[model samples]
Target: MSVENKKLPQSYYVPAQSPWPIVGAIALFFIAVGSGLTIMQLNNSNVSGVFLLVIGLAILFVMLFSWFKDVITESNNGLYSTQMDVSFKQAMLWFIFSEVMFFLVFFGALFYTRNLSVPWLGGASNNVMTQQILWPDFQSFWPLLKTPAGDTTQAMGWQGLPLINTLILITSSVTLHIAENAMKVNNRRKLQTFIGLTVVLGGCFLTLQVQEYIHAYTELGLTLQSGVYGNTFYLLTGFHGLHVTLGLILLVIVYARILRGHFNDQQHFALQAGSWYWHFVDVVWLCLFFLVYVF
Candidate 1:
């Protein structure tokens, strides 16, 4: 490659037009509508929501496959330059930032429920009827044990399974970082070893997480309908687990590409993006460990 080809003006930046975005948007629309209808059908017992949700997810998977294929084709064709690398970096940064905001929304809601809503219901401020008429035994506290409806559950502590998962995720993040740095330095053996270790560690964390959930549900009698404690606990951890699953999938794709001799030392944006995503998932798990498990 010529040095001139390595650098290009921003004005020359042009990506091929693709229809995947529109298709993805349509799929999401179906998902939103289907979920709404499904919730509304809770009492009537209709099944349209299930059908729509499945179709929407299938469309989404198709869109992802098509879009990723196009990208890989472009990369293999040598159509991308250093400017494209910069664009990928910027795009990944913005994507992670958006995800940070997504988690922040949920965390904010958790905080609001714990600090505001619970107190108001317990008559901490003005309304004495909050205690006199409703919830006479309601006690406002973090890692809420009881819901306003009187359902109770034991809070998940930070000492056992959660702490182990936290350590596992953190170690995976470190190994992934080592793999990324190895890639940058063209240490292919080290890169493979680190990435493989990272993948194994991630799998371990997920396995432990499932065990924890089982212990919570079966051993501790904690369940989704147990109360707000169970609700928030599941919501936060479940969302984080979904992200971890996605990160694992991305890592697997990168590993396959590596085996195929696809990415080079300097041109491994997909690998870097996957690493960033994995690390982001790890950090989110840390926050969840502190807030959800540790209190």
Candidate 2:
């Protein structure tokens, strides 16, 4: 039930056609244009790339805040019913499914590079002539530290910050679960405490991630320029970091709503959806840690 107090209505409620969709589309357009220009500006001296990017980001922020406000208002006003609740659940599930596919593409790239391309280049099968002509001295390894172009870099290990961050994320999942349980029992204090802990844990993960990046760039000489190894490494972990950041933002919003008592056990889809997204993020990280870091 989307609204706890409202009696279930037979007629489905449809929101009026709103400006948010168009506003979101406009914001995406600007962001797309800005991203392209910014990438192009990397070579040339174009300044509008960054300017448009900032404007797009601002519009996006406004849209998210206002759109969420509208939704929350509608929800609290008992304008929603079970139909609306089902729609929200389906929407969230599909959104997460799309995100999974997005990451799947990256993981596929990693697989193709490591399992097929690298091995074939290293004279696997009868491709000895191919290796001889292409990269005669290339020593095929999982990390591929030394590139055929003679650029060398160190692989990031699963020790220290990476390991600690992995533990932090796992613990966050536990805390979020406890928070959900507390909410179910109407234990506001426990709910707030655990959810707040989840937020702090998320922040700590991001902080450590930044530090890890710094160490990679400054000390390890691992960067985007270090051939396919660096490219895949950064692409996988960097995008995962971005997802984590987004998940943290969601958690913060849910926490704020919880503080306002916007959610009781019956009317907590927002928190439930937020938790679902966060858990999905955690699963992605686990895959990244094992496949990208441990192995």
Model 2 scores a C-alpha lDDT of 0.91
Q: Determine which window of 10 residues in candidate 2 has minimal summed lDDT.
A: 1-10
Q: Estimate each model's TM-score.
A: 0.85, 0.90
**Residue 150, candidate 2: how far off, in angstroms?**
2.0
Give the lDDT of residue 159 in candidate 1. Answer: 94
Output the lDDT of residue 89, model 2: 99
Candidate 1 lDDT, tens digit per residue, 15-39? 7688999999998998888877875
lDDT of 2 by residue, 1-295 (tens): 4688887656577888889889999998998899778756866787899999889888988998889989989999998988889999999999999999999999999999999999999999798998999999877789988866687899999999999999999999999999999989999999999999999999999999999999998999898777898989888998899789878888898999988878998889988998999999999999999999998
What's model 2's lDDT at 182?
A: 95
Q: Which sections of candidate 1 miss by over 4 Å? A: 1-13, 29-53
lDDT of each: 0.84, 0.91
